[model samples]
Target chain A: MSYDFYMPVRVLGGESVVKTQAQRLREFGECCLIVTGGSGAKNSGALQDTQDALHSVGVAFEVFDRIEQNPQTETCRQAGEVARRCGADFLIGIGGGSALDATKAVAVFAANPELSADDIYKMQLSASPLPTVGIGTTAGTGSEVSGVSVLTDTKGVKHSIKGEQVYFKLVLADWRYTASCPYSVTVSTALDAFMHAAEGWLGPKCGEAPTAFAVMCLPILWKELKRMYKTQELPDSEQRKRLYHASLNAGFTLNQCGTLFPHQTGYILTEHYGVPHGRA
Target chain B: MSYDFYMPVRVLGGESVVKTQAQRLREFGECCLIVTGGSGAKNSGALQDTQDALHSVGVAFEVFDRIEQNPQTETCRQAGEVARRCGADFLIGIGGGSALDATKAVAVFAANPELSADDIYKMQLSASPLPTVGIGTTAGTGSEVSGVSVLTDTKGVKHSIKGEQVYFKLVLADWRYTASCPYSVTVSTALDAFMHAAEGWLGPKCGEAPTAFAVMCLPILWKELKRMYKTQELPDSEQRKRLYHASLNAGFTLNQCGTLFPHQTGYILTEHYGVPHGRA
Candidate 1:
């Protein structure tokens, strides 16, 4: 009976989605900042495609590749300063959860230079955050469509900055980008996507819309997980595409109902034990 | 595989939703216009609640109630002129499909005064349409969340003006508003909602998101539709609420997949044969 559905992100999925829909990026502004982790964007070929699209559309750009695993708030602040100094009008995030999540915080800082890194959690801003375009290279994070950004503070504690303001304005979901994931990373990210769907499905807040997304995604993730469990093999291209899209569906579920016990406890293992977020 | 999802309307649903969420109206601007059919808005008590909410928020307003069944382009143009003269910043649409559909066209005309009534179909505007708030008093149409507006042209031909431009900025869905519908209206509107779900379920364009919405709403609609066939009685308050919500779910489905044969042919019957849209 819960009929409150309100996700505003526009998602376009296909092969070479960025190339086909590059004109959409121009709507944000003439110049941009591209944010990513050290290697995922290059490894997945998303960086090349994003640059090509921007070049074709005649949009000037710069890259900030310092975001790490469990993104640090101070790092995001530095990237924001870079964007402001370069006069970048919008931000393009290309990578997994960490890089994309950092991009959200960077956008807030970029728009509000007066606020320090820690002030992001306080949620006080004189101006709205810069609009973000997310090009997700990994299948697990769902950060492309979600507003929740988990960032490590100066104390090394993980706190989330969440609200409608942080949601990406556009998401170019190309499953081809996920085909490059190594075996362990693939397994871990698949687990993360599965956990997202499972937690939302079991959560008290799961309503009609969230339940529909969960139902649509859980079976897809289950089939892939079962195959991987039996074979100990990396998914084929078709399976990779399915997994990537399933992760997006799971993201929609998680976006609506949010995470439950596992996510809360998983952060602890990630922070202290050097565990990857999904595996933890 | 079709992973394009982009509906931006924010929907809030529950009993007395308007009164509880009245403050949201203030975000649009200082002054507004309310558009509706003659009695549905008043009889449903949505008008009084809307007025009270607007007054409480200190947002000035005016009402235009001349819209009739299968809204005409000329009528909407006139309403837009009224809104322009009054200096209304935004528009609130209350009632069934006709009123809601007219409001969408009125929004376009209000922002583009130089364009004649027939020019709306051409989809040309120097500026974006005014933001719209849709309050549904009927279980059918789903116009609150959709961007397609079916308006009669100068030749009395029913052509649709569609795109993201016509989408409402916000939607307040109170099932209580639908409780006032009599037996015939209840039956017809329910059938219209059923047709939307069924058509989208069967359509070739029905993708994962649309199918999820179709699956969620189909059973609820089927149960009520079957009961109505056997009992031939009006639905109680609880049933009315269920039906109203089911229609919204169906609306989500229709908004994504759109209608096929029935909707195209049904308009002909409605325009020429004087048959009610749903029954046709």
Candidate 2:
């Protein structure tokens, strides 16, 4: 027996991947926490499509559509209670990492209940969580690709849920969902993905999982994310997939070695000032 | 909120990592199922150390000690039942990928009995497993870094359990453990990690997250695994860490793009004749 690795979520990212995957999600969980970015998913018709998919699956769900940027601990706790009360067997963290992180914490908290926000730190008694699936409307965060759920605590302390058990059971990446993203979001998220790769490469414990591959892909992400930030015309999946792959690598390495320098030090920025979780 | 990318297992490899990590396992699951190779971890004293670790944590465990090379479906099913009957909350797939993969499947079957070995290949599913921790005494397979769990079905068809849910919460790697690895297994597994990097680079999905970094790390793993196979004395964590890092990248890349022609074609070789799953 060797070591184990987990990413149980079935990820599908493309034009039709959302609907196709929604069909699959129907068979699995109970009520979902249909997390959205304030109101975009509702307005963009993606929410309607998602609802349509849920209806097709015949699964009941409620939306925690009010998740704000850089979700606060209070919000996650509220979501947790809702999930617990709703008897939500499965959680769908449908928006970006904010909602997703909230979904992760809420699912775990709802299932276990005893673990408060305080227990989520690196050293504390923690249990496995309720099953979850992610839908990426943006390509950054790569929350879909990792197990660490970064959330801002009430005191604004960024707490990261560092176990693989928190990885989403499914990550549906519909590039089309991200296509209409505000230009600012695209650049920032892509930059965040690049950072995941860069930090992973530079991190102290970067293991032999193949660091060179991650390094090589860095330039591509750097160039392209920058280009999209400036040009705004998106790269096709073939091109974008490279960075996605790199982001995943970055996630793997960083998760192993952990984020070095900027990431570790960035907490000061987030905690002291009012910097957003992703930017700092 | 953008995507958050990461490979979630916290790895502690190089010589004394198992012993070092044993302290932390107390924070892992309550009960662990020590999944081992056909007596390899025992002979190496790794099993004894693991036992000591569990005992120190005041944790309890049972061993599934009969895992074989190129582990088959029956092993997983049987082990899964054993784990279920034992009510094991945590599992330690303690040797290489065979034991690890089998242990992963067993955890899955133990959690969700309805899904058969055959169902995994068609699509990724919830392998509802207890929190699993993998300790790699051997650095091949890259199983520590991947969620792809492969097992031969009843007809000897190699099926894979793919997704994040099966990933280990923590991966403890101690190069010292490899001190007793048979020269050949060491060679093959190292080569396998090498192939994982090479093939992942060549595959179509090389464009995904951190593939560049993963791609770049290949040679380092190739170089060290080869040297380790030849000399068996590369205790320098710096060097071994490089290989470990490369393998992690390769694992991430392969998980995304998978092996290209070689992996696809190798399946036929196994199906028609009888090539070992790792034999390239």
The most accurate candidate by TM-score is: 1
- What TM value does model 1 have? 0.96
lDDT of 1 by residue, B1-280 (tens): 5787878889888888899898899999999999999799999999999999999999999999999998999999999999999999999999999999999999999999998989999988998999999999999777888879999998888999999899999999999899898888888898999999999879887777778888988888889989988999888888988898889889888988889998999999999998887778
* Model 2 Cα shift for residue B241 (angstroms): 6.3
Q: Is the docking of candidate 1 incorrect, acceptable, medium or high quality?
A: high
Pick the lDDT winner.
1
Error of 1 at A91 (Å): 1.6
Please write out the lDDT profile of model 2 over residues A1-280, one tens digit for every residue: 1222334345555556667666778766756767666655654456777878888788898887777777766777677778878777787777776777777777777776676666655424455677887776666676776768877777767777767577777776665556555656666667777777777767665544435435555787788877776777767655555555445445544554466677767678767886654567
Worst 10 residues of 2 chain B by lDDT: B1-10
**Model 2 C-alpha lDDT versus the unseen true structure:** 0.67
Candidate 2 DockQ, CA atoms? 0.19
